[model samples]
Target: MKFTLFSLCRRYPIWVAVLLLYAVASLVSPAMLNPDQVLNIVRVTAFLGMVATGQTIVLLTGGIDLSVAGVVTLVNILSTGLMLGDNGNIFVAMLACVAVAAIVGVTNGVLVAYFRIAPIIATLAMNSILFGVALVYTGGAPHGAAAPAFNTIAQGDILGFPASGVCWLVLSIAVAMLMRKTVFGRWIYAVGANARAAAMMGVPVRLVVVAAYTLSSMLAMCGGLLVTAYIGNPSLGIGNSFMMTSVVAVVVGGTALSGGVGGVVTTIAGALFITELNSFTNIAQASTGAQFVIQGVLIAASVVVYRLLARRPRA
Candidate 1:
């Protein structure tokens, strides 16, 4: 009973922390409770929340993608380049973006699964290569404006709430169902918990790993597209921070670095938490260094608590 309770507690620390943070923020400034401010938080948080969803999946498989930011860069470039002043060509442009994103995903998966490279090192090297590709493709500058329709997807409201936020919620529900009510979901946990044992049990470990990465890449592309719409112009390296940010959100959301745990709901909460922290800090006139210190301390504290709860006492 204690073990079960402890496990549940570790899995949900993010939600608990998020509630506390929201409560504190609300108290600190009632303006934080204003409907528009709350909407703004949800609006901005959805993009990263989607990216973190994919990140959580990969992390569940005991893998990581340091190339997500690079992938987003590539996607944004494609979106603008293909759709530039050509609304009629939108479908083709989108198809190309998806294809490229999937190809990148497959490449990463092949390297990590068949080549057996360490996830972090493999993805990091891939990121370097991707960075070079982005630079070469854009010649250090990228141009082209987002289509009005695409921008609407990112910025429009549905029933007075941000469309992207609604999309995030829908996607979150779909992913939750996938993770909790499917055999493949069970396979993910099994493989993450013990790949060797999973393989011995006849699970297709390689395929699962590949699929996880492919999904991550595709989701990242989706995020990039949204960001591209929001920004309305492509800039080189606009998404440079997303890889690390997504990883941090996933980790801080109570997802185990060791894998086979956590959910998209937690990841969404984590993204919101981080976003809120940044906004609050900015509002409070905190320096960049102070923000860093606070973030570092919060992450350290969360990890310590997670590790403590995850530890099994000797019988």
Candidate 2:
């Protein structure tokens, strides 16, 4: 069992780093050393983890989605407005939200895949468009309440577990399976590693890229909806932090910014680490601006270290 655990650690070195960080944070923040803090960490991690999963997919194809915050904000506005605290309307409202989210994803995909625009530029522009659309739809201040039933999806417990945490676990496991056990996963890796080569080998490179972007946006939508439910109302920039934090989580998880080297496990671990760090910040009474600075530093440090490790001479 010891050897087996050791082998698993060797297979996933980032997990070891995450554990170390967790231990250090726990030691520093006595509050976080308790069992309840574990659940708290999982609950918060769920929201970021969902977004990170989508970002992971896009990054795996050597692409990035800067529009996630927009998608989340838009979805949050639409879902709450449509539900209007009516449980009877939740199904329809959620369906509408998901549809709109998918359309946004498709737009991002088409721009990047068909128009040949840079992913970063395309998604950034889309982010502006989405925010504008949301503002127009809300007439500036969004006003509506999430259905009580809908709130249960994120706010309530499921079999003694936070529903959001359960959702996170399920999504993490499913995405991990998809990445490791599917043909589409192979295509993702291939295209990220080399689009031209993948296309030469008859892979539907454009389709894959589009699918990845679409999936990324939809996942962001899921996070948005859950956040809306959790928060019980509407806000314009609720998801703004997600835009950068998702990227940070993906990078901190050991994924290559250049693509082709990340998975669901890595991303979930990253999300957990980020959430844990944030909790520590709160406990330590760090300024909000300091939190952003810390995250930015983490991203830069991750990239530098990853690039350096990649450059190392192989045995």
Candidate 3:
């Protein structure tokens, strides 16, 4: 196969964006170049990275999971409430959280894959349901705190790197490999590229779709756990930011909103770029509305740029 600049950019726009953003950020705020500050960005990116990883998978399968935000909040509230600051409760809390997340994921999968509901509407409705359950469970006032031991996952370091970052790195590598080297991974892409064709080819389209959604929810739960660990307390709307940000990361990473393109690897850079952008905005004292506007522009720009690059003929 021949290579071209447009192809290269199409394959790795987010990586380019990350480098450019870092260069600009360092020039604008020298503190951004600090080792500690860089680590802090990595640390914070882990939470969104974890969630966006799943988003990447779902997008690959031609689906969206708006419910991720709800999953995150529900998991956060449930895990902390169940843990109640006790180490012994951590296991039970986690198990419960996993179960709940799985149920939610399965429901989303069934609705989209079997019942033929549109992904956006299905996941959006699911999000509402999940948030409602969380509200009812907490009565608008969540209780409990993260156990000290559990907090180590997000707050502690491994070999001078944030533990959560390390975890994100390991999981990303594992997931990337799965998507690239496994039959199931192939099925996901096949289904996304054309579900009718994939089904005709005996790809088990519904199963793949269901599995993708399940994995998405599970990873969202993992993200929720990490965030809960960092905050150490439950709060309503704790995951509100992730709803759009997760999609932003995935889209900016060059994943096709239409599906069957992009992978988790680029999303790592996408996550880093987003965190760096947020950090830079904070350092520059930009208003919250400004940040949102910037993000919206970024998303639109990325979509247009990627589409253009994708349309360019190979050299």
Candidate 4:
């Protein structure tokens, strides 16, 4: 029994840490521990979990989408502008939003896959471009009332649970199954594990890379839309924090930065851990500066710990 538990911890160190954090939080803040807080954390996790889902796929393909933050902001600005405070036109605005994400995704893929630009550089450039466009379009201050129908996707709850949680669960299961059960999914892992080998084996490497980026951008856009709904307004830089957080969540979920070794299921758990961490900091009254420092240290520490664990030999 002892060895079985130890093996489980080694195999899923991130999950062990998450459970430990929750246990500590419950003990430290007994008054703050309640059903409502747990439910709120679940809802918030759903939002980040969706973003993490896409990031997981991209990371598994050995790519990262730094422009998710910018794409999300631009989606909000464009959708809000189109909605024009009208719920009836929400679908039209959503279509426009999706189209924009598709365009950005293709551009990122082309720059990285076709032009042979580095993933970091390509996505970073895209982020700057998108950020500039959003600033120019919104004049740096975005203000628009979200459509009621669209807003309900984030706000409405069914059976006493948040709608976002349900959405996240459905997406999580679908994406996990997609990656596990489909040929294309296998192709993604193969490409990530070794793009050259995957192509040599007759896999459509470039097409798969493009699709990965496109899917990631679309999910980020979806998360952005939900953010707008949750906040009930369009806000500039609303997604500014998600880019790094998503990457960290992916890493903490035990997804390799080198790619081809992680899944959305663990990524969801990582997202929940992060959400709880954020809440814990709030409860502890940590300053913004302290939080940033702590977060940075966390990424660095996670990398180090992962490497150490990976180096450990088994009997």
- RMSD each, Å: 2.8, 2.1, 1.7, 1.8
Write model 4 residue lDDT over 1-315, tens digit each, in one string. Answer: 356877777778888888888888888886447989888888888778888888888899999999989987888788888887898889898898889999999999888789989888999899889889989988987767788877777888869899888888888789899899999899999999999999999999999889888888888888888787787677777879888998989888888989888888889888988888889888888998888897778777877877888898853
lDDT of 1 by residue, 30-129 (tens): 7788889889888888888878888888899899988888888888888888888567767877898899889988888888888999999888998888
TM-score of candidate 1 against the unseen true structure: 0.93
Q: For model 2, how does the per-residue alpha-carbon lDDT over 116-175 read when each residue is reduced to its tens digit?
A: 999999999999999999999999989888999899878888877889988878977898
**What is the C-alpha RMSD, rounded to one decimal, of candidate 4?**
1.8
- TM-score of candidate 2 on Cα atoms, chains taken together: 0.94
Question: Of the candidates shown, which would achieve the greatest TM-score relative to the real structure?
Answer: 3
Q: How accurate is candidate 3 locally (lDDT)?
A: 0.92
Which tens-of-lDDT digit does each residue in 203-246 have in candidate 3? 99998999999999998998999999999999888989898899
The weakest ten consecutive residues by lDDT in model 2 span 1-10
Worst 10 residues of 4 by lDDT: 1-10
The model with the greater TM-score, 1 or 4, is 4
Better of 2 and 4 by lDDT: 2
Name the best candidate (by lDDT): 3
Q: List the residue pairs that clash in candidate 4.
A: none
TM-score of each: 0.93, 0.94, 0.96, 0.94
Cα error, residue 23 of model 4, in Å, equals: 0.6
Q: How many Å off is the CA of 157 in candidate 2?
A: 1.2
